[model samples]
Target: MSQETASWVRDVLAGRAEPVEPRPAATVMLVREGADPGGLEVYLLRRVSSMPFAPGAHVFPGGSVDRRDIDHEVRWAGPAPAEWARRLGAAEPLARALVCAAVRETFEESGVLLAGASADEVVSDTRGADWEADRTALIDHSLSFAEFLDRRDLVLRSDLLRPWSQWITPLAEVRRYDTRFFAAVLPEGQQTRDVGGEADHVAWMRPAEAIEGWRSGAMAMLPPTVSSLKDLAAYATLPGVMAARRTIVPIQPELREVDGEVRLVVPEGVDYPL
Candidate 1:
């Protein structure tokens, strides 16, 4: 390991350094079919190199949960906030905010809305000029997600989302997030565009392919993204994947120096590559 990294790890382990407080965040694995005939395809965006966090790394569409996302004024359908709280292992308000943030961030970043006018129906298209304006507004925080939904007469579809995993940024990093992960199928007729401030390029890619790129050092993926892709690569059907159950466990990787190499390491049997 570089002498600097080794010293940093030692300081952190010895409690000489305290990790920055992690802010709550959320991300979605938007999946569909295209690449492997037997596997699922996912949406990915490459953050610009200038981004303050994870620059140039390819990530799912998401961001930190906006405070207004907790607004009770939002019209919600599907699983109640209390039930989601039990599943997500969080208080009701945070659970509601997480779900609302998931849907809102997805629309803002990828142009895909997992909401509907009624409980049973999802919007087929989001290509209208007005929709783009709202998307931009959401990104800039000029419009709250609740207001947008109310104005459009849409209901947030919490049922459409499946909680996947939770990961926290390492304390060693100045930028940190307590990010909740969600997976949802790409809605039909709606498409993801290369939108967002830092994402300059976007694509519908297979998890295996993305992993292969990372293996070849042709792409950059954070530890959580890498681990999730490995897990995602195993599933072939949307129904099977979504039908599976998961217990929400928070994983925070630690930085360690091993045999002169500094590496960020997940827990044993965590199935993550450095």
Candidate 2:
């Protein structure tokens, strides 16, 4: 890491600088379906080593919520934002905002837009030029996600996102995310590209294959991503995979170092979905 980047990370770690608080972040696990049934894949991004957080780890496209994600003017579908908030044990208003942030971050990171007609109509012309700029502003606190959406008369397609799993970073980590994982089938005519500036590379791989690669030292994965991939390997089709989302449970693993190797301990007797 560069000296400047290392210094920033050290400040966050030493409490001299506060990394943003652990807020609701969203990750989209895109799966493709096929007749032969063996080609299913999920999108993965290898974050740049210079990143202060999770450098060099292959991870899903995601980031923290921004204040702009809460505009009531933004359109949405599926369960109400209030309901999602209740599920997450957060305030109703903030829950809605986080949902918007998740969708926006996924698009900004992967170049896969999830919003439909209504949301598109507003910024249909400017989306190409302004989307990334707006996203950058939100990340830097210069603008809000919802405000940016409203400026273009767009609405978030919350219906397209299905909650899969929830995980909180161990308290020991200086930077954390109270992340919610969602699954979506790769949309028709839309493809994922390596638009995430923070990522060094991107690829589509089967969950099992990714696990094998990580085991063989060809890939490096953070614990949460590894766990999610393991959970995904159980389903064969998009519909089947999404059906599993109905059983949502929060997983907060206790960090443990056993036999000189770090591991996350899921509580005994409690059935873990992943």
Candidate 3:
């Protein structure tokens, strides 16, 4: 931790400062099969340094929920909101909004849309001027997820996503998020483009390779991103990752004075890459 962060941690711990309430947010890890038979690769975006949160970090596509994310008019498929509520350990309303934000952010940041015309189908491609216009509208807040789905005559394919984990930003940080992490397979026929906005670079990399890059200081990632990459590295294929059941639990790292320096400490047995 930097000296400035350590000072903030000390202030917060000493009750000289109050921690900010974290905003609810969601992020998704998009995975796909690689050339190596059982190996998988993940989609990642290097956030531009100008970003307030995790600037210059290689992160998944996600952001905070907009008020309209809770719109009831959104078309849906797969699990019901009640089931999503149970899985996310949230009420039906917030659960629905989180899922909506996940799908919307995925489409907004990446070109991939996890929606289809019917319950069993998925959008094959999201290219061309029309799709770009809608995406831009959503980014600018002129278009809502519900309005976009309704206009496209599509339903959010919730079945394509699996709950991974929930992470809360540490109290000492100036900005915080009660963010949920989700795992998803890159839908067939859809491709990721160099969608320039918050991110400066995008790539499809093996989880282990990403980890190695972080270790070599070639890439920067937050704790949740590193932890998620570690989890993904355990799986050999996309199916293996999607098939594994996850018990969604919130992990909020604590600020501790370790050897005269303040550091973010995760739970025991959970590794935090230095």
Candidate 4:
């Protein structure tokens, strides 16, 4: 850890610093099949260094849940919010908001909409001038997610999302997020655009390649991202990943000073090479 990180841990451990409450957030790993058999690729964004949180780090598409995301008026399909609540171990409203935020953020950050005109369908092409206008509005908060979907007569495809895991920001950090992780296959016919906003660069990379980049010091990632990628590397195909059952458990790393260096201590069985 750096000098600042070590000092923060010392202050927080000594009760000289108070930890901020983590904000509820959501993120999704958008995956697709590669040209090679049993190969999977994931979308990643490198946040701009000037951003307040996770700057210069490669991350999945996501953000904090908006108040409008919880509104029940939004169209829905597949499993109900109650079912999602059961799966996520959260309340129905929160579960709905998390799913909504996951879809909304993915579209805002990657130009991929996890919605369709009918329950069994997904939007084929989210391109052209009018689509860009609504996307811009959503980013600016000038339009609510419910309103956007209602206006377009689209249903939020809840079945498209698969619950993966949950991670809470460590107490030593000033900005914290209680983020829920989700996995979804890239909808057919929808392509990722540069969509430059919070991120300066974006790309599709196999999980193994991403892990190698992190190991080689060519990429920056938090422990959660590293762990997620490591776990993802185990899967051979997108369907295999989406079909696997997961128990959503919250993992929060603690800060400790060992051998004169501050280290983030994760729980047992959750291993990541530092």
Candidate 5:
């Protein structure tokens, strides 16, 4: 059978002939030192139009958790996985995996590696080809992240990640992600490159400017992403951004039809997911 025919058959078997279901996912926002106090620049990826979900949207790097993420073992920092699970009101295993996936996806989508010892130590030259090969193997299900870490004797560096918000896609959408958002300052000397083929393009832009771009029709963004960017725009520095994160109360907005168009409206004084 032709490749197109095989894809259609697979989709039909997976119930894509009907509607898609909302699944758990995670996104990481990478900030780096810039010229100004609020020089916070976020890494954005424009997903390819051929993807099954959120096709052609400029989004933070993230995706649904694979079963392997749950079983994988690696040294970790930050809040315990169980604690994160409770805060997110999800099962322990799934929550833990979500965090792992967030870190893994960030590295895969961007060339920046958040996991390492002191920022100084990470600057030593490393083999990008080797890392890319491993990433490909992991994505192909031939290697687990746990194995990847073990082979490299690296830690997960959970302390580098901070929970920002949680969001659930509207039920009306055929595809959805129960996504958790995390923030991390880019490690010293680690630069972000657009290497993930899933994204057609990538850029580093301040939150306010990105929102303005969206309004001016210079860019297209999903509602959650827009809302998140607006929230980030209120802060001026990495510390300020982290401080504001502590006060965030995850708000999953209710989707309603306004003027015959779908819109998500959240309660005031609450942080909406991106």
Candidate 6:
């Protein structure tokens, strides 16, 4: 935590500061393999130490939804914006943006595209000079998502995504994000490249193994990551994990004092040692 953030947390816990507005954001957990505990793997990126939020913390690929993502011109497939809006608890436009951001950010950060020529297919290979150009443009915000998709004649594969959870940053933090989490099976033959910029390192980690790293103080994770890993640890396979219905809940943690120590408290029933 930053020094200012630590001070803000103290103040919030002391009831001396007001919470800030949380920005809408999206993130995805990409998994591959089957039912075996050892077989299940998730991609994680360690945000660069220079990042203002979650510096040096291991996280999935995601960011705040770009306003342009709501553009009606974006080539879209799968659920219509109205149905998606109802499902995500947002206006039609924002719901569209959230879904778009989920796919776009995944491609931007990890070099994997959750899009294809049609609803039934996924782009098997994202490696090429042309694809690299679009990726760079997307990162720089030089190209709008709709235009990018239009140029390639690709459709966003919203069906490939499964809603997982929603988490909000604690009031104590200077930067807050209301993030919607989604899960997807890493498309076969579409591998993640380092594509370093915001991240210093990347790896494939099992939920239980990742928790062990945190237990030994070898890696850092935010509360949502910690809790999500625990929830995921119970599942044996992607199909089982995705098929089970969940009542989507909004989890916004807060600062609390316990036993003379001040700590950020995530909601109850989150089983993490951290």
Q: Pick the candidate with the highest lDDT.
A: 4
How many residue pairs clash in each candidate at the backbone level?
2, 6, 0, 0, 1, 0
What are the models' TM-scores? 0.93, 0.78, 0.96, 0.96, 0.83, 0.93
How does model 3 fare in lDDT? 0.91
Q: Each candidate: what lDDT?
A: 0.88, 0.71, 0.91, 0.92, 0.73, 0.86
lDDT against true structure, model 4: 0.92
The list of candidate 3 runs beyond 4 A from truth reads: 1-6, 271-274
Residue 207, candidate 6: Cα error in Å is 1.5
Could you tell me how far off, in angstroms, the CA of residue 92 lies in candidate 1 after the best superposition?
1.2
Model 1: what TM-score? 0.93
Report the C-alpha lDDT of model 6 over 148-196, residue by residue, as the tens digit: 9999999999988888888888877778899988888899899999999
Q: What is the lDDT of residue 52 in candidate 6?
A: 84
lDDT of 1 at 257: 58
- Residue lDDT tens for model 3, 60-145: 99999889999999999999999999999989999999999999999999999999999999999999999999999999999989
Ranking 2 against 4 by lDDT, winner = 4
Candidate 1 worst ten-residue window by lDDT = 1-10
- For model 4, the stretches where C-alpha displacement exceeds 4 angstroms are 1-8
Worst 10 residues of 4 by lDDT: 1-10
RMSD of 3: 1.5
Candidate 4 TM-score over all chains jointly: 0.96
Winner on TM-score (1 vs 2): 1
**Stretches of candidate 1 exceeding 4 Å from the true structure:** 1-11, 35-37, 258-261
Better of 4 and 6 by lDDT: 4
* lDDT sort, best first: 4, 3, 1, 6, 5, 2
Local accuracy of candidate 5 as per-residue lDDT tens digits, 120-168: 2342223389988887777787988788777776767766778887777
Deviation (Å) of 227 in candidate 5: 1.4
